[model samples]
Target: MSGKRSIFEEVGETTPRREAPQGGMIDKGRGRARSAIRLWLMVLFALVALMIAVGGLTRLTDSGLSITEWKPLTGALPPLTTADWEAEFALYQAIPEFQVQNSWMQLEDFKAIYWWEWGHRQLGRVIGLVWAVGFLAFLALRKIPAGWTGRLVFIGALGGVQGAVGWWMVSSGLTGTMTDVASYRLATHLGLAFVILGFIAWYIFLLGREERELMQARRGKEAKLFGLATGWLHFAFLQILIGALVAGIDAGRSYTDWPLMGGQVLPPSIWLADLGWRNFFENPGLVQFIHRITGYLLLAFGIMVWMRGRRSANSATGAAFTAAFVALCGQVVLGIATVLYGAPWQVAIVHQVLAVLLWVLILRARFLSLYPLPQSIRRA
Candidate 1:
C-alpha cells in the first residue's frame, strides 16, 4: 500500500490515477438511428413539397379530373401506346369536366392535361413507396429509435388517407354539371396535405437534435413563446385552407384589384349564392374576402409572436421567429400581387411556394421554443 504523504510533501506521490471511461451500453445504442432517420425524413419532406407544388399546377391547368378512376395499383403506369391513350381519353371524355367545359379539346389537348394529372398521381405513388421502404428497412434492421415507431407509422397512415382524399376530390367533378371539384372538398384535400407536411416537418426538427440535448433543452423551454408559436401555426393553417377555397373556385381571378375587391370594401357580389353558407364556399367574392381578412389577421398575430420571440434568451430562437415573420410579411405582399395580376399561373405558383417556406419557418421557430439551442453569453 502506498503511504499517506504529509501536507507539505509532494501530493502527486500518493494520488491514484484511473482510466477515462467509455460510453455505457445504454448511451451507446440510444438514438443511433437518428441521423439515418433524419435523412429519410428529409427526402420525404422534399417529395411532399414537390407533390404540393405539382398539385397546385394540376389545379391551375384544370387537369385534376382528367383521370377519372382511382386505380392505385394500375394508375402508377401512365398510358403508353396509342390504344391506351385513346382508352384514357374516352374515360375523361365521359366526365363533366370534359363534356361541360373542354368539349373543344382534341385528343392532343386531352393528353396535355392527362400528363399533368398523371404526373401528380405518379408522384404520390412515389412518396408512398419511399415511406414504406424506409420505414420497413429501419424496422427490419431494428435501427428505429425508441419512442418513434408510432410517429413514423403515423406518417404512412396520413399518406394513405391523402391518396383516398385525392380520389375523393377528383370524384367530385366527375358527375352532374360540376366542371370542377367541390370547393370544400378541395379545401379539405389541401388542408390534409398541410397537416401531413406539418407532422413531417416537426419530426425532422426533433430528429435534427440528439435526445440528450433535447432533454436538457426542455428545462429552458420558453413556454409563452411556444404557446404563441402554436397559435400562429394553427391560424396560418386555417388561412391556407381558406386560400385553397379561393383557389378551388378561382376566386383570386375574380378580383383584379388589391386592398379592395372590385373597388369596394367587400365585393358587391359577396353574398350572391342561394344559401348563406354556400356563399362562403361557392361565392368567389366571399371566399376571397375571407381569405384576405384571415391573411391580415394571421399577419397581425405573427407579428406579436415575433415580437415575443425576439426577446428569447437564445439567439437562434429569435432568428427563427424573425425569419418566419419576414416570410409572413412577404406572403401578404404576394397575396396582394396575386390578386392584382388576376392569379396568373406563374405569380400564383410563386405565392404558393412562399406559403410553404413561411410554414416551415413558423414550424422551426415553434420547435426552438420547445428546444432552444444553447448560445454564448457574449451578447449584450
Candidate 2:
C-alpha cells in the first residue's frame, strides 16, 4: 500500500509545456489564422484591381499628367477652394503636357482631368495604408504564419517603390518635348502593378488550403504540365508588357483594321523612322505590329498548354486550364475589336479588365499543376 504522509510533499513530477514551433514552420493548428490573413490579402487584391481600372481610365482620358506634384501625404486632399483649384491648374499649365497638348483647356476642363488623377492616386494611398496596418498588426501580434513575413513585406516594399516610379513616370512629361510619359516608363509602371497582383493572387491560392494538404497534393504533381504552364505564364506576362507599350503610345488607334495594318499585311515604312531603334517604341505602326504578332504567338502557346492540361488526372486542374483558354480567346476577340474601333475608352478599359482576368486564370491553372487537389475515387 502507498501512503502520502506529508501534506507539504509534491504529489507528482511537473512537466514543462511544449512551445509551438516558429521560423518557417507553421503550427498546423493555425488554420483560422491563415484564413484571416488570406481574407486581408483578398481585400487588398480587390482594391488593387480597382486601382488598375482607374489607372486605365486615367490614361485613356489623358489625365495622368494633370497632377503636377507628388505629395504622398498632403495630396490626398483635392482642391477645395477656387484659389486652390487655380493654383493646381497653374502647376499643370507649367508642364509640357498642358502647354503643348491641353493649352485650349480652361479651369473647369482641368478640374475634370484633375479629379481622375486625384482619384487614382487616392486609391493608391488607401492600398498602402491598408497594407501597413494589416502587416503591423499581424507582426505585433505574432500571428503571421512562418515564412510569410518576408513575402508580405516584399509587397509593401514594391508598393513604396511603385509610388516613386509613378512620380518618375509623371516627371517625364513635366518637361522636355514630351506631352506624355515615355512609353517604356509607362510599361515599367504597369508591369510592376501586374507583378504585385500576381504575387497576391499566388499567396491567396497557397493559403486557401492547409499546409498538409498542399504537401500531400505535391506528391502527384504534373511536372511537365507545370513547366509548360509556367512558360505560358511568362509568355502571357510578356504580352501584357507589349500591350502596355501599345497603350502608352496610342498605337492601337493607328490602324482600324483587323489582320491588316492600313489594308496591308504590314504598314508601309515600318522602319523608316529617323532612329531605327526608336521605331519599336515610338512608331505606332511597328509597335502595334509587334503587339499583334505577340498575341498570335501567345494564343498558339496557350493552346499547347491547354492540350497538355486536358490530360491532367485531376478534374479541377483540367477545368482551370480549359477556362483559361476560353478567356484567352475572348480576350483576343476583345483586343481585335478594340483595335478596330480605335481603342475607345470604354472598349479599351474592358480589354484591360479581361487581360487581368485571363492572367489570374492562367495563374490558377499553373498553380494546380504545381499542387493538384486530391479527389477520391468511388467504388463500382
Residue runs of model 2 more than 4 Å from their true location after superposition: 1-26, 376-380
lDDT of 1 by residue, 152-223 (tens): 999999999999999999989999999999988998998998889999999999988777778888988989
Instruction: State how far residue 256 of model 2 sits from its true place (Å).
Output: 0.6
Compared to the true structure, candidate 1 yields what TM-score?
0.93
Candidate with best TM-score = 1
Q: Point out where model 1 deviates above 4 Å.
A: 1-27, 30-32, 376-380
TM-score of each: 0.93, 0.92
lDDT tens digits by residue: candidate 2, 281-367: 899899999999999999999888999898788888999999999999999999999998999999999999998999999999999
State the local distance difference test value for candidate 1: 0.90
